[model samples]
Target: MDRITPRQALRMVVIAATALCFLMPLYWLTISALRPEADIFRFLNPFGPWTLIPNQLTADNIVGLWSGSFSRAIVNSIVVALVTVIAGLMVCASAAFALAVIEFPGRGVVFTTMIVSFLIPFDAIAVPLYSIMRGFNLQNSYAGLVLPGIGNGLAVFLLRQFFQGIPKELREAAMVDGMGWFRIFWSIYLPLSRPALVSAALIMFIFQWQAYLWPLLIAPSNDMKVAAVALAQFSSAYNVSFGLIFAGAAFLSLIPMLIFVFFQQYFTSSVAATGSKE
Candidate 1:
């Protein structure tokens, strides 16, 4: 076995400690959810082992969530995220393909404008967007929830960067063999762009998944509320249920973590490829 130097051992200790610092809140949230409603705050003031570990566990919080609009909100969030991922990928990927592979007037200008769009704050345009959705009679509809997410600028930029990394020879060869642009994109570019596609899917999925303000503005009704918005409704001026809040937070936080863990390799690949190319 290789012996560790004192400096290397110290580095490992520091890294472990840093990781624990970040994980502590998540650990507390999970345990708080499992704890009895009263016990959820009992351990916080004079913090001790009990603060980190639940002595009496209960499933009431978790069970109660499914009995209300929270369940519907989770389903709504899933539907919205999936739709955004599928539709966003198609729209962004096609735009990326055009920007990267096709020759057109003002392509550079168009791509630059897109790159600038993501930098703008969504909050700045939320009210105007809400008005537009209402005007189109899309308020309280999934279409309203999904339309804004489909034109993800960062996803387009990421896909376009990855697409640019592919050799032009492949596209040229396909064209020489009478392959149409759509066929060439479908048969060649897509098969080779799995990592980029996964990355873009994650972006669009996260955009819709974490949506709060937009969903609140566009779909205020209980039937159309998403998980984030539903989480907020758990609180009230009269009484606040910290147990339910913690439970909902734990459930909401677990999803993105699972997704990122599952698709982490593809995400890393796409990020590295994008950075290296452009």
Candidate 2:
């Protein structure tokens, strides 16, 4: 192998430094989770050896987190995420298809309005959303969790872009053959748009899984709480348990990491395709 030049070496150093900056908090969390509770404050003795003593390793924190309502929260998060993905895909895909394929009046206006809606922050809608849910008696229910995720403006925009990229000839030929619009969509458009679908699903799943504020505000009970909200119940200002808190956090991190790993190829390909079109 050729030796790296000065420029290459400098680039490598910059990349390494950037990676370390991102990974430092994660490393600290893992180390803190494994350290004995007493040694967590050892940073106060700046000159002391930084070694993690072997006796500090314990599964008590992990076990405790799992035994409490944490496990239930994990299940709740998984269910809500899956439901959200299914609901979002069904609604967004159909809406995208209509906007892309049909020549309806006000189509451009409607599409533009949907895109503009994405700019509105969730905080702006929280109060009105809560009142609407309260009126429907959906608070603290799975329906409450899944309903909000189904109407994402970004999902509709992304799928519409992908749908518009489909060749017009294919749809025209399908129509000439007397095929219904729905059949053409199912047979041609959807199969070719798998990459976009997977990409959108992965993004939506992460957003739903890690949602904190809405779930926290609407679903405060143990039975309805998601993992992000449940994790907060473990810590308080005065009575903090560093090991257990970190353990719970580490466990929570793994869920999204696994989802991303599973769909990483589709995500990369879809993003590359989207970028190339622009």
Candidate 3:
């Protein structure tokens, strides 16, 4: 039997503490959402077990969310995120294929520009983008919500790296067999690059799912409001409902968390492959 050394025991303690620090917020949010509204902040000043574990749990907060515009917002967000993921994957994957497989002029420069574009905070360009959407008469529409997320730079970069990692010999052989670029990309590269595609899809889904400012700008009407934007409205209402806010946020977080958990293996592999290839 193996015995733990002092150093190994200390390392385990440190790891447990770090993980607790990361999970504490989520734990608090879950408890807050379950607790009675008045009790939500009762343990804040002198934190205790009650700070995380509520004395009484209620479904009212969660149930109340469905009674308001929040339910609509959730639906709108799901529709937008799904559309963004599907469209973004297609656009990003095609761009990646071009950058990775095709011989083209200024490809490096284009890729560099794409990388730099994502580095520039999206907020910086939000106003101009809002104006552009308005000009296209897409304001207060799903198209407005879905269009920006479809051109995700990071998704493109991730796919491009993964595409580059695929062996060139496969592409050459396919060409020798008289397969066209589109056919090769659709049939060969797409099938082999599932991990990268899942990673990129997660990226686009998260971008649209968590979107606030852009949705606020482009689709402010109650009918078109997204979950994040709706959550913000909760705090600003005449009587702020912290419990509802927490519940909505908890619900909002569950989808992405579940998605990453399910696809985490693929996401990790794709990222590691990109790092090695790069």
Highest TM-score scorer: 1
Tell me the tens digit of each residue's lDDT in model 1 across 1-278.
29999999999999999999999999899998888899987889897888887899899989977786688888988889988899899999999999999999999899999989999888689999899889999988999999999998999999999999999999999999999999989999999998889878988887888788899899989898888987887785256788778888899998898988888777677679799998
Candidate 3 — worst ten consecutive residues by lDDT sum?
264-273
Model 1 lowest lDDT segment of ten: 234-243
- Clash count (model 2, backbone only): 0
Ordered from best to worst TM-score, the candidate numbers read 1, 3, 2
- As for candidate 1, its clashing pairs are none
Q: Against the true structure, what is each candidate's TM-score?
A: 0.91, 0.86, 0.88
How far does residue 42 in candidate 3 sit from its true spot (Å)?
3.2
lDDT of 3 at 240: 95
How accurate locally is residue 274 in candidate 3, as Cα lDDT from 0 to 100? Answer: 91
**lDDT assessment of candidate 2:** 0.82
Give model 1's TM-score versus the native structure. Answer: 0.91
Q: lDDT by residue for model 3 over 1-278, one digit each (tens)? A: 29999999999999999999998898889888888888998877697877777899999999998997799999999999998888889999999999999999999998998899899899789999999889999999999999888888899899999999999999999999999999999999999988778878878887887788899999999999999999998999999999899999999988888887888787677679799998
Please list the residue runs of candidate 1 whose C-alpha ends up more than 4 Å from where it truly belongs after superposition.
1-5, 267-278
Give Cα distance to truth, residue 85, candidate 1, Å: 0.9
The residue-level lDDT of candidate 2 at 267 comes to 66
